[model samples]
Target: MLKQYKESSQQTYAYGLVDHLNWLDANRLTVASVRADHLRLYMNALTGQGAGVYGVAWRERPPLSNSAAANVATVVKAFYLTSNQADPSVVAWFSRDSSIPQHRRRAVTQNPLSPRRGSARPRFLPDEIVTALFEPGVLTSARDVMVVTWLVDSGIRVGGLCGLRFPDLHLVRDHPCGQRKDPHVHIVGRDDNPNRARAKAYHSWRTSPDGYVNDGVIRAVSEAMIGSFYAYLLDEYHPNQHLVDHEQVLIHTKGHSAGAALTTGGVRKMLRRASQRADLNSYITPHAFRHRAAANLYAASDFNADLVAQEFGWSRAEQVTELYGRSANRHTMKYLTEAWDSIPGRPTGRD
Candidate 1:
């Protein structure tokens, strides 16, 4: 699983497996003996629809959300499939229906537990909340400000931001490293970082003979982002450079861990604290900035999903289109209203 998935994903699966294993123990059911019907019963218990022996364990907790339940089901199914490689009989338990096509049979048969994909809208921070967060005293440190600025301006994943190395940053235009004429940062995916902050995307990157990165996903930075970065460098970063041992761009600036590369967990904790200080009605997250940035880019690019996808390192515009279709609808309605108003003979609502 470590070779096939990111550490974070493996951790999630491990957690889900633990829950399943506990439930199985409560019911005295071994993995080899559990059938499709038993699995359905387990799902029912997870969803709070059935009272199994494990019900006592989960009685105090709320039922799993649709997405979370789906994840657990997926994890369980994957576990059995892997087990099936050693024992072929496990396949019969999952694919009991003979009518199902051979190619269509999946390890996890879809049931009521499956979540409807593409139904939920991506949550983003509102402009007013973002403005409030930027106000003086809301974010007290240059490092915090720079973190928010980069997330909002570039829409890079928090993992990518935390995983950044000094060599990945090309702050000057016409950098001696590559042919890109604008200031940009390369997001390089690595599994070996001491911080375990890995870039989600797997775009290939290699350093040039001159010690500059090339061929990674390049995220263009705004002037504001560059300014905040410099502020962090001069005001906080440079003063603490003597304590650093690694090349990662973002690092702990205080305590015994000062100068160590920051992790995704650290970024989340920082945002949570900043959000609380800003007196926000709801909690803010690092990915909210990415969502807002995508929406802003979608509107700024004249509703071009392709451009938004390219800017955000997405492999396909279809992913962007699905995520930002709501933005497109809002802009399209505004344009339609303006077009109607332009017609001289059109009746006003006042009439």
Candidate 2:
């Protein structure tokens, strides 16, 4: 049942199911005996306004945010579906489409998943934050600097960055794939990695890391990023004799785990500490770098949504234009207003 998802996603689904199981145990109900009413009670308890105890061990935990609730519902549904397929003896007890009688065909209001559309507004870091990240001493480690440079320049997800192998990088202008005017990195998903870092939904090249049978995508990197990467590899990474056999791009250089592969959470924590040291927003997330890169690419491409989408590996231009083009949109709106006001006989506010 867990084989369909990436390791990280499988872990997430496990946690969500654990939460549901905890609720069942606390309510003295068994999964085999559950029905729509029990599901409603469970959802109500998750929301924390219901009559029963919220969670078995979540007494101190607050109600889940809307997106989180929706995700939990999704995982729960998957669990039931997988279970049904695995063992049909268990009754088809809960369903997303199943409805409660009182709510006008709406699936039991309490059992229904929270609306998924109200996800938090996407945020992109300003240009100044990028400058701050690269400032001298802001990131003391070459590895940190290189990581930031790659994220901003390549716009790969943090997991993809963590999963990166040395051989996947074509930092030079030439490669077996073809000659390129610019350097680029190949992003692929691997299920066997110790760090569990992977590109979401990218499994085509899972078995062939450096082969032509890759379903992976290549993203161009700036010369500056390439320089930083080499500096990190030659100076920081290669010097670690312990990591001579390792293939991962970013490795630990401090503490007992020096030269070991870095996990995605460890990278986020490293960035947080660096941001704190630099007097920047400590809440600055890795994804914010991706957003900033997408926005910058959009603006630099003259608000060409397709160009931005291609650069960011988004299948749809709408994803780039609508979600990640805030900075470019600001520029676009300003230019439109300026052109309108400059027209001959255009009405002015004072007119």
Candidate 3:
């Protein structure tokens, strides 16, 4: 799950969790035995670094947004809770540990970084702007909508989206394709030789990290989109003549011929072009859609934070407080206008 989300090295987040877990095991601290203070300490450690040391991997790109850092913290916390479910003694230990400590953050004042500046930020389009972003054959054009929709609806990172396969999508309702809870649209990421022993459903290429589901999201992904994706696969993606079967979802164009699959870089390029057409400011990119969706859901929801988080496969809602922060309070004027004016032929100013 972590590997699938595009950002600074997503794998780093997963690996970091592993590193933290190993430390806990080495110290004889059970997962439920972990507490908020410990998680806070990890967060503080991450924040203390000069931007140079924070995560050199994302050179040229901006530091992970504060929201992203918090999310990573939440995932780490979940790692303990989920791993500790069998032991009640550990659970008691964590509750008494208390909340994260308040600390003044230091500025990341480093200049010697590696790679390109463009990589620093993963770009995305805002939802409203997306309607006008595509241009038939060009980037953000008609060809772009399916893949773009994949990012918006699935919220899967570029890598995961790139790792999808045709068999993964659920063409019919109720009956899951391949038995995975992941929507019928096949996730592209897969392990080199994953332990299929316990991996029946959730056919994501990357190993499973967390298990959170939002039924509303499942409901929002229309069957029409799935059908369109199917048409795309059959009409566009072709594995190859030599390969009897291949395991990838979104494929690349074969210079007028179909090829294996779209590369991660290719996905990024498409996103960039789409954002440009949408007339979004420089900051908006393909990834902005996920942020937008999470943000939109937070605003539109009836203060149902947990419900909103569940749809995005998020395990914790507390950290998303910022996303759901203002909510619909100020936006209530729209509702009021509709509510009173449409009261079954009620008198209007014009009348």
Best prediction by TM-score: 1
lDDT of candidate 1? Answer: 0.79
Give per-residue CA lDDT, model 1, range 1-351, as digits (tens): 323656657767788788888887877878777766667777877877655523345335688766688878777766776674424555555445556777776654554334445465777567799898898898878999999999888878998999898899999998887657899888989877879988888888998998999877888889999999999989888988998888888878888988888889988998888889889887788887887788888888888889888878889998777885454455577789899999998888894
| Ranking of all candidate structures by their TM-score, best first | 1, 2, 3
TM-score of each: 0.83, 0.78, 0.50
Worst 10 contiguous positions by lDDT, candidate 1 = 51-60
Report the number of clashing residue pairs per model.
0, 0, 33
Report how far residue 146 has shifted in candidate 3, in Å: 1.0
Where model 3 places Cα greater than 4 Å from the true spot, the runs are: 1-127, 135-143, 176-189, 193-220, 238-245, 256-258, 277-280, 324-351
List the candidates ranked by lDDT, beginning with the highest: 1, 2, 3
lDDT of 3 by residue, 77-160 (tens): 445445635255434443333433334222321111111122122232344565655445435322356777666665555554
**Model 3: how far residue 305 lies from native, Å:** 2.0
Superposed model 2: Cα runs more than 4 Å off? 4-8, 26-29, 32-68, 82-114, 179-181, 206-215, 332-351
